[model samples]
Target: MATTTRERLISLLSDTNEYKSGQKLSEVLGCSRTAVWKHIEELRKEGYIVEAVQKKGYRITTRPNNLIPGEIKHQLDTKKLGHEIHYEESVASTQEIAHQHALKGAPEGSIVIADEQTSGRGRLGRAWHSPKRSGVWMSVILRPNIPPQKAPQLTLLAAVSVVQGIEEVTGVDAQIKWPNDILIDGKKVVGILTELQAEADRVNSVIIGIGINVNTPIEAFPDDIATIATSLKIASGKEVERAYLVRAILEKMEKLYHLYLDHGFAPIKLLWEGSAASLGKRVRVRTITGELYGNAQGITEEGVLLVEDDEGTIHRVYSADIDIPRES
Candidate 1:
């Protein structure tokens, strides 16, 4: 299908925020003035504040500050990551949408992003704070030919890429919390949520959702999470452009993702273990059944955590909420 008339109008408006005459727009876009008016109406319905004047044809009044589909695609410079992005003003979760798309045979590298996720979640179904215009909430769809068992490696690979991108774009020394939370200083700055679709022990697609606190201030977060959660703005001492960070992440993620497909998880795992601060530390982890206190020796080949208790018994943790380790 050809690009929608609304998309054409948006592109025209994005080029210059000032009013472009209706006749001029129609001529530039190769469409009837009625089509231009209809497209403008649709864009207004979609929540973009557009003003129509008697002489001054149309102008973008207010842009929803976000990595929304059209805006993100306009600003992106990449071969992948967000090439097939779907952006939402509000969604229950990007992961949920990406999962549906994955099941419906979306492309291998499709992505879903939103300004606010009403039901954003993390590993083991923990709630993720996703407020509007304050973070990078995205789900990436990938169809890697890797085994189902090796899927968790993708999360580590994603974490490393996020850390690299955040540091490069925002100049913050973001650290990796074991398993998948990216932290700045001692607070959580980003959360990674990875979901898989497989059948008969063969992996089909992996939907990786990342929620990074990019611009939310300390007051914007809930009382319970504010003390522990942080944004790139707070850490970097200024507002970091969400689009730049997203592009940086996609570039790094695509490189590492391709590397993982060509080579194995060994190289990515080494990079993760290096950036990871939780390795070889005494810590407490909570699983579904109970809590386990032990030394976090390292992760196993399949991305399971290897925790050794006081009795020297090694336990492989499939999933858990790990407390940040206090330096001894």
Candidate 2:
């Protein structure tokens, strides 16, 4: 595919640390120097810091903070994951679109990302507050060759991937909570919801919904969740670039997914356990049938939680809302 003029301009400027003259850019792109100038302005409008000097041409001083597909796809390292992207301005949910694509046999690792999700969904159909231009509201479609019963393990794997990505990008030590929540300083920072399309014995596709509070302000949260929810910017005292975070997550996820497919879930399970915040702590889990108050021992091979109650009975929790241990 031929690259667009704007894309070519971005590429030329991004490929080198030194500036290229306007005449040289015009000759290479087969366009007028005025066109190059226009594209440079467009790049600036997209949040890229472009430096233009008298002797030197245009050079990109800093990358854009936005999650534009072109900005994210520029230097992404993944092979198949994120190869095909469905970008939207606003939507009800990326999971809904990913499901539609998966039903049409979309390739594994296909992703649907949106700037804002009006009706973002969490575990148990809870409303995930996803305001415009504040968070990462995206869903990934996976067509793995595994039984549907083992699908819960993917949620755990995704939590590890997210924590790794956040730590790598922002230098924040994020931890995982039970099944699929990422926390920092004992506050929620990320949430993962996994939905599957499967039959009795086989699996069609798995749509993993990931919502990360990247640059959301503390005041943006509602009164109900203000105390329990936080964002990377709020914790680190600096705004996190969403584009870099997205690429890092895709790269980490592809690596982990390949590891899971080759060596089973043992490696991912170890990583997940290492980053768990609720392990070996007194916790309360609210399930559909009833509530269980016990010590969170560990997770099973199928990614189920093993909670030991006060009566010395072990309960296997497949799905529930876990209350983290309170500070002393």
Candidate 3:
């Protein structure tokens, strides 16, 4: 499998021994020396630090040092997610550019990422504070064979993936706040905005915009959000490598998306519940219609939030701003 080959190549390159010859790698990988050479060339095109010499063979020197297109391409070890990544130093919003690209028939695994966004956003058209070099503001163009009604489920799936990815990469226990927020130490570190393109009931593509606070300094946030906003650097007490985190996120999303396609939302819903912070807690949900004060029960099978108010009425909330109520 392509994934297996990629993994094996990474494992081999990670070996601390001196550069292993292509002939040796061919024998070890159980493939032809030409096959090993081809893999090395591919790695080079993707931005790896592969060192090829007449006698020394190929030895990966070091992973790229940035999250730019070249670096992300070089460090990626997955078969999907970012098989083709389009990165920009600045943009209005990746979602906007991704939608345009998807409309023009971009590949399913293509990812549109930006180091900074002039106008990033979240659900309900709220602004997402994404400053330059402080976070990941990116979107993916996915052409899934799913119905439009079930599009909301992808948001939850992404929430789960973001939490898992952040935890795996930064070693911080990030929690989910309902639909699409990854909170670490009770503060939001990640947010997702999922947009879909469909032909009535049929689907065209799903562009999922993700905003992750990576190396944000403590005092970087605005005064209002300073207490509530945080970064992986702050949560982990160390500055994490951005490219590795980006790759981890893409890998996690690709794996979860495959499962979602195989079996509706059941599996992802369970995982979301396990790490969710709002479920089973006293909460107040404010929606456009009105407010629903209740205890947060599990979400509906369709990804709608289920809340039981004080009157025992179960409210199926499609969209709401949820807050964990503080006791007097």
Candidate 4:
């Protein structure tokens, strides 16, 4: 990944504690001193606090709390997952951009991310509330050499990655609801949507869209979802760093994805089931066909939900909204 001029500028400013002279910056960045000043102004407009003195040139005192590529890729420890990042200030959806990139043969681990999603969506076309700079709204493109039918397992894998990532970052014990929801204290803090581009037998690419409510406050949620949706800030009582969380999730996803490709879904499934919240409970699963009320059994090898309804009937649920009933 070739670094942009702005990225190089940021790197230079961030690596040292003392200020960098304009002449020194221009010499290292291979640009005119006027151009270096323009870049510093641009950084200021993007919410970066670049302190400049008459003789002491410039130094970045603070960076914006946004998911700009420069901010995320700075010291990001990942082999492939976030090497190629497409960052936008606001977009309808990162998934839409990821699909286009995938069709154009973007490499695996290329990610599309945004500060705000104007038209973010969840499973079943539900509107996902993604305010600007309040959450982690991103999509990762992966070209895995596996059957298309095995794609759903990646959603489970992503859920596990997110659960582990959230715990690692915020010390919040997040749990996975069936399919693709991560909850803390029984309120949703993250959502995952996996889409695939495949031919009959060969898989082209898989786009995993992960939306995490990082620093959003409780009152910011819409009235309809306010009761059920929560953010990491609300759960952990501290402002979670969105960029760090994104890096952590990408690292975890890369590791788990390799594990799945090498060992199979057995290891991933065990890790997923360890953090599942709906298992071994009475729940109601609402599918497109109808609603089924039953005991929440374990997932199958293919990541299908197995729910045993009354009369000892086990229904295989490929996709559905699961609701775990509270104990009476």
Candidate 5:
């Protein structure tokens, strides 16, 4: 992967605490001083705070809270997950864009990310609330050579990745709510949606959309979900840097993805269970056909939810909305 000048510029500025002169920057970057100034201006436009002194030249004092690709790539340490990124200021949906990219032969690990998503969706076509620059709105494309029946395991894998990522970057102990949601302090903070492109019995691509309410204020949520939804800033009592969180997630995703490929879903399932919130609790699962009340046992190898009802009947829930009681 070739690093762009802007990425290199970010790296250079980030590598040291002292200011580098414009002439020196131009010399190192192999461009004229005027071009270096233009690049600095571009950085400012992207919300970087570059301190320019008379004799000391320029140094970056602050980076934006948004997920600028250059900033992310400069800090990203991943083999393939985020090597090819498609970033947008605002879009209808990263998942939709990723689907288009996948159809055009976008390689595995290609990701589509955005600052805001107007039509972001979750499982069962629920609208995902994505305000401008307040959350992690991204979709990762994976082409795993697994059977279609095993695709649901990727969703569980993603949930674990998100939980670990949040803990790694923000130091907030996040847990997974059966299937797709990540919660902190018993409130929703993250959502994962997985879509698949397959033919016959082979898997082509898996688009996993992950949305994290990073720095959004509690008041920013819609009234209907204000009481139930929370953000990382609220949980940690400080503004969480989106770029660092993004890099952490991609790195974890790439690592876990390779682990899944080389080994299998067993290891991923163990990690998921370690962070699961609903297991071993009495709960109600609502499927399209009906609702069943049971004690959440655990997940199967195929990523199906196992619920043991009152009659000692263990039911395999393929797709459903679960409700774990507060008392339980």
Candidate 6:
């Protein structure tokens, strides 16, 4: 993808601490000085504070916490993921738009990102609370050549990617709550919802919706989730750049995805297990079939949750809401 003028400006500003003169920027970017000045104005409008001096040129004084596409695209190191980004200020759901794009044959790694989601959904139709401009609310499109039955493994793959992204960007330790949730210090920080469009035998596309609580304030959450949900800023005691985290996720996702496609799920499975929060814990899983109480053993080869009950019967859970018991 060709970088935009704004992206080039951001790159130049972020690549160094010294001020970049307008003439130098124009000469390097092959644009007129007026165009460079306009781009700098545009960057200021996007919440970046650029310091301009009489002869010292311009330097980035501060950056916005918002996940503007230009900022994210400029930092992305992936070949395919986030190549085509559809950004929105507010939307009912990124998943809905991503599904529409996927059905219309949107390329793999096309992304639908929003500043806020009015009706964001989590697993089992739970409403995901996404306030305006406080989080990363986006959905990623994937067209892997895998069977429909193996699609659930993609959730694990996404979980690993998100965990890695959070760790790399925030420096806060986080773990995966099996299947799709990411937790920091036992509080949920990220959620992944994977939806597939498929026929009976084959798979067409997979929409992976990833909602991250990056800079959300504690009070922004409802009373019900305030204690359980946390943001990277909350966990790290400092605000994290949303664009940097988003770029990290795409990079990790692309690398892990190629690993899955070439070597298979074994490597991804091991990585997922290493960061899982539910493995070997006593828990209650509420699935569509029924509730199961047992020791969370591990995941099956197909990414199914394996729970060993009291009688030594191992149950393979396809889908469920897990609740790990706490010590009395």
Best model per TM-score: 5
Point out the higher-scoring one by lDDT: 1 or 2. 2
lDDT, candidate 6, 9-122, per-residue tens? 888887446999999999999999999999899889888999898897898888887777777897688999988888999999999999999999899999999999999999
TM-score of each: 0.82, 0.92, 0.82, 0.94, 0.97, 0.94
Model 2: worst 10 consecutive residues (lDDT sum): 1-10
Candidate 4 is scored at a TM of 0.94
RMSD of 5: 1.2
Per-model lDDT: 0.84, 0.89, 0.84, 0.92, 0.91, 0.90
All-Cα superposition RMSD per candidate: 3.9, 2.2, 5.2, 1.7, 1.2, 1.7
**Tens digits of lDDT, candidate 5, 92-117:** 99999999999999988888999999
| Model 3 accuracy (lDDT, Cα) | 0.84
User: By lDDT, who's the top model here?
Assistant: 4
Candidate 3 least-lDDT 10 residues: 1-10
- Candidate 4 lDDT for residue 61: 91
Please report the TM-score between candidate 5 and the true structure: 0.97
Candidate 6 weakest lDDT stretch, 10 residues: 8-17
Model 6 regions more than 4 Å off: none
Clash pairs, model 4 backbone: none
Q: In candidate 3, what are the lDDT values of residues 179-297, reduced to their tens digit? A: 78888877889999889899888889999999999999989898999988899999899988887888888888889999999988999999999999898898889888887788999
The C-alpha stretches of model 2 lying farther than 4 A from their native spots are 1-8, 22-38, 53-55
Question: How many clashes (backbone atoms < 3 Å, residues ≥3 apart in a chain or on different chains) does model 1 have?
Answer: 0
